[model samples]
Structure formats: structure tokens, C-alpha cells
Target: MLVLTRRKHQSIMIGDDIEITIAAVEGDQVKLGINAPKHVEIHRKEVYLAIEEANREAVSDVARVDLKRIMGQLGGSE
Candidate 1:
């Protein structure tokens, strides 16, 4: 893990695009502002984990479904 100390208004660049700036510091909380392209996705750790778990559950549910039977029930033939 890369750790660095940044004062308010100070920023650090990731590559050529992403920039993470220290917006404010109040007591024990620190606010950050991130600047990145629209294509980049940024989510909190908990939210990301939840999304991953949901995706895993969806795949598991799909695996348990009989696709061929469903298609046949819908009057479709392979």
C-alpha cells in the first residue's frame, strides 16, 4: 500500500488522468475530491463489495436454472 500525507488543497496524480485532492480536514474526518474521466468508476469499499456479492449471487442463481427446459417451455427448439 502506498501512503502519503497531504495537506488541504494538495493533490496527487495517479497516472495522466486521475487526481485525488485533499479537500478539507476537520477533527478526525478528512474530505477528498477526486477528478477523473467519466469512464472511470469510483465507489466506496462497502458498496463495491455489495455489488460484487450481488453479481456472484446472480450467477449462482442462473447456474441453478435450466435454460434448455425454459426454452422448451417457451415453445422454442434448439
Candidate 2:
């Protein structure tokens, strides 16, 4: 991992589009301001991990569904 120190209002750029700015520092907590395009998704590390875990769980649950039963209930060849 790349580690760099930036004071409040200082910014670090990633590629041409993403910028992360230090907005405030209070004791052990630091607030950040990110500037990026709408297509870009940004999430806190913990939140991202939780979302990833949730998605994996959802996918696993879907795999266990009874496809034949669903098809039987829906009927075939509309």
C-alpha cells in the first residue's frame, strides 16, 4: 500500500479523474472529501467489505433456489 501524509485541504490525485482531499482532522478521526465522476463508486473500507460479503451471501442463497419448482409454478412456453 502507498502511504502519504496530507494536511487538511491537501489533495492526492489518482489517474486523471479521481481526487481525495483531506477535509478535517479531529483527534483520531479524519474526514475526507472525494471528487470523482458519477460513474465512479467510493465507499469506506468497512462498508465495502460488508457490501461484498452481503453480495456473496445473496449469490449463495440464489444458488440454492429450486429452479424446477419455479419453472413448474410459472408454466413453460408462453
Candidate 3:
């Protein structure tokens, strides 16, 4: 993990395109402003994790249904 110290109005660059800036600091909360290309995706860590979990669950459900179908075709119990 890369650790950086930035104050309000300060900024950091990621590669050549993405820039993250410190917008405000209020007590324990810190606000950030991010700039990137339209093609890029930026999500909060928790939101990203939830999306990943949902995707995994969807895939798992689809695989289970496929396996059941294959098993029924083979004259096996689902």
C-alpha cells in the first residue's frame, strides 16, 4: 500500500490521467475530489466490495442452475 500525506487543496496523481485531491477535512471525516477520464470507474471501498460480492453471487447462482440442468439431462438427481 502506498501512504501519502495531503492537506486540504493538495492533490496526488495516479499514472497520467487520474488525480485525487483533498477537498475538505471535517473532524474525523475527510472529503475527496477525484478527476479521471469518463471511461474510468471510481467507487468507495465498501461499495466496490459489495458490487464484487453481488457479481460472485450471480455467477454462482447461474453455475448452480447450469449444473442442475446438466445433471437432469444425465438422469441424475438435481
Candidate 4:
């Protein structure tokens, strides 16, 4: 992991697209301002993790379902 110290109003660039700026600092909390293209997705780490976990659970639930039995019940063409 790369660690860099930035003071308020300082900015960092990612590749040629994204920019992160320090907007404010108060006590131990720091506020950030981000600039990026609309196609780029940005999320807080915890929120991202939650989304990933939910996707995994959805996939697992689908895998556990008896699709063949449901198709038979619906009179699907075998």
C-alpha cells in the first residue's frame, strides 16, 4: 500500500482520469473531494464490500435453487 501525507487543499491524481483532493480537516476526521469521469465508480470501502458480499449471496442462492424441478412444474419443453 502506498501511503502519502496530504494537507488540506492538496490533490492526488490517479492515472489520467481520477483526482482526489483534501477538502477539509477537523480533529481526526478529514473530508475529501473527488473528481472523475461519470463512467468511473467510486464507493467507500465498507459499502463496496457490502455490495460484493450481497452479490455473492445472490449467486449462491441461485445455485441452490432446483431449476429443473421448477421447469418441469411449468411444463417446459424438455
* Top candidate, metric lDDT: 3
TM-score of each: 0.82, 0.79, 0.87, 0.81
Cand. 2 TM to true fold:
0.79
lDDT of each: 0.93, 0.92, 0.97, 0.93
**lDDT digits (tens) for residues 1-78 of candidate 3:** 999999999999999999999999999999999999999999999999999999999999999999998988889643
| Minimal lDDT window, size 10, model 4 | 63-72
- Per-residue lDDT of 38-75 in model 1, one digit per residue for the tens? 99999999999999999999988887686756877788
Task: Please identify which of the two predictions, 1 or 3, would achieve the higher lDDT against the true structure.
Answer: 3
1 or 3, which is superior by TM-score? 3
lDDT of 4 by residue, 1-78 (tens): 999999999999999999999999999899999999999989999999999999999988887686756877789664
As for TM-score, the candidate ahead, 1 or 4, is 1
User: How high is the lDDT of residue 34 in model 1?
Assistant: 98
lDDT of 4 at 17: 90
Better model by TM-score, 2 or 4?
Answer: 4
RMSD of 2: 3.9
lDDT of 2 by residue, 1-78 (tens): 999999999999999999999999999999999999999989989999999999999987787676766887789655
